[model samples]
Target chain A: MQKQKIIFISLFVLVIAYFGGSYLYKNWYTQNLDFMAKENTSVFIRPHSPIYGDANAKNYIIDFFDPACETCKAFHPFVESIMKKHPGKFKLVLRYAPFHTDSYYVVQMLEAAKFQGKYDETLNVLFKYQNRWASHHSPNISLIWAFLPEAGLDVEKLRDDMKKPEIDAIIKQDITDGKTLGVTKTPQFFVNGKPLIKFGYKELQELIESEL
Target chain B: MPPLQKTSNLAWNILFLCWLTATIATLGSLFFSEVMMFPPCIMCWYQRICMYPLVIIFFVALFPLDTKVVKYAQPFVFIGLFFAIYQNLLYYKILPESAQPCSQGVSCTSDYINWFGFLTIQMLSLIAFSIILILLLFFKRKAI
Candidate 1:
């Protein structure tokens, strides 16, 4: 009887521990959403001109992306490799449609870099350090400036451009275009004017070839 | 039968019921999170690693329902219990919390799924662990 009583007490203690631990964890998880979770958005973009079969031997592809989106980050390297492989054949347009709060800053910074002809450099830095800003309070602006010389852009000009309303307008236009095309997620792509519905390198290659 | 035998049988019965309940809840949580749009956090993934195998392991244990099967399952349940306890400690902040930092696209600590105010992924693991521990104690006497 005494042994049974001891066993019962142990079981009761275990149960209490389980419940107590669970409650505490759940509270922490929910409260930290600002730093952890990304908000959903409905946005799309339209290219400057109609993208169809390259009548002028130039093909345009636009990627509507959110910097903080995991899928977009994963897709970046592949897209970059494609550009490197077929450099002049493809003219890629990158549009920012922020899906999460932090993403907006990345988009704004990228636009500022574009103003100084350092778009590619800024993009590479952002994607490479994606994990840092996605998890932390905010990114280091000094890091962005440090990469300016490597990107072959003037640091002072890049900094000045960051404060311009024109950069904000461009970002806004991308969002407006994204909404028009019914884009509600990150990494939405367009070849010519038609949205690429399927994902994967094979399908994207096929679609690009068909347009070519 | 002697009193020892009766107690052993009762323990086994309770253990079986607890395992069944825990397994069912785990499958339910998976469906709720994966298919139902709730996302799982890092601790949640660890709990999943512990619970997912039990669905198959317990079903297999049910086939023979003998001492041999109990011996085989004992280690698995114990290992699972260890992980569950470890996770509970992490969640409760009793131990130092360490998670793979968030990358641009994937937040390691992101908690996308929460149920009933307190039912996080780690909580589910604790429930499963407790059930298995109780069952193990019950079967220990019988195996002896």
Candidate 2:
């Protein structure tokens, strides 16, 4: 009976510690958001980060995304449609968080496409044919190469440009920033530095609307 | 083996409680997956398979108190308890992710509803299965 009581007390303490830990972690998550949301924080935006809509827009949507994430692919059009609702009011700055295996290679393809002014079509095509290339278990760069032509990308130019150091630096910085922002999942969105703390399509819309 | 003799109301009631446990567990699993729309991971599905059938099996066993129905239900309880323990191990990351299913889409590790930040759907299943297994063992001893 005494041994059982000791075991029961230990389990109770462990449960308390578990709840306490997540609470502390949540506080840290909010504190990091508050710090990065401050104006002119380089962590929010870098010079090379891809942006859609008016660059001068007051409202910024920082999307920390993995190219291979299914949720990110699903949210792609939804986010665009959201921007369409409030034209020129919001600028989406995409930050790479390549959490998936071999997603870095896909990110390279995307960053390389920018050099030839085919970034938009490339992103669309990659998303369209994501299942063929980003197979989760065995991502194949060759398969992505086959689909790039549909996006009118100069395959030769893209190959050469992807080997550059600048794209690598951009990915590295975005990854570092993503960690600092407490991004554990893909399609993590922040509007004007305020994170979409509660995850839902409706929550995203509300956050965007409030910022608007 | 001799047939079960006329048992007291307390014994019958306790046996019925086993079915009640299974019934509640089935409804809870359905509620989380169907109503709440949280997609069940592969591990969740496996645990459900080992759990859902016991509701009917135990109910059949209780109405007549057949030893054979209890025998059939015992394997399910043991299997479900194993799944519950294995799932908790995977959920807590004690087991490596290489063995985990749904590594790509709708990550098995994704905390759909983390109650008290520690108790997850898997942990809840673990608790339910553990209780049912214990009750079933006591019922088995009473049957003999």
How many Å off is the CA of A200 in candidate 1?
4.3
Q: Alpha-carbon error at B17 in model 2, in Å?
A: 5.8
* Per-model CA lDDT versus the true structure: 0.61, 0.79
lDDT (10s digit) by residue, model 2, range B84-106: 88878877889987897667655
**Native RMSD of candidate 2 (Å):** 8.8
DockQ of each: 0.05, 0.04
What digit string (tens of lDDT, one per residue) describes model 1 on residues B54-117? 6566555544344455566666667767766766666666866554332344343334446887
Model 2 chain B poorest ten-residue lDDT run: B1-10
Backbone collisions counted per model: 12, 0
Over 4 Å off, model 1: A1-109, A117-152, A159-212, B2-22, B25-42, B94-110, B141-144
How close to the true structure is residue A116 of candidate 1, measured as C-alpha lDDT? 68
Q: List the residue pairs that clash in candidate 2.
A: none
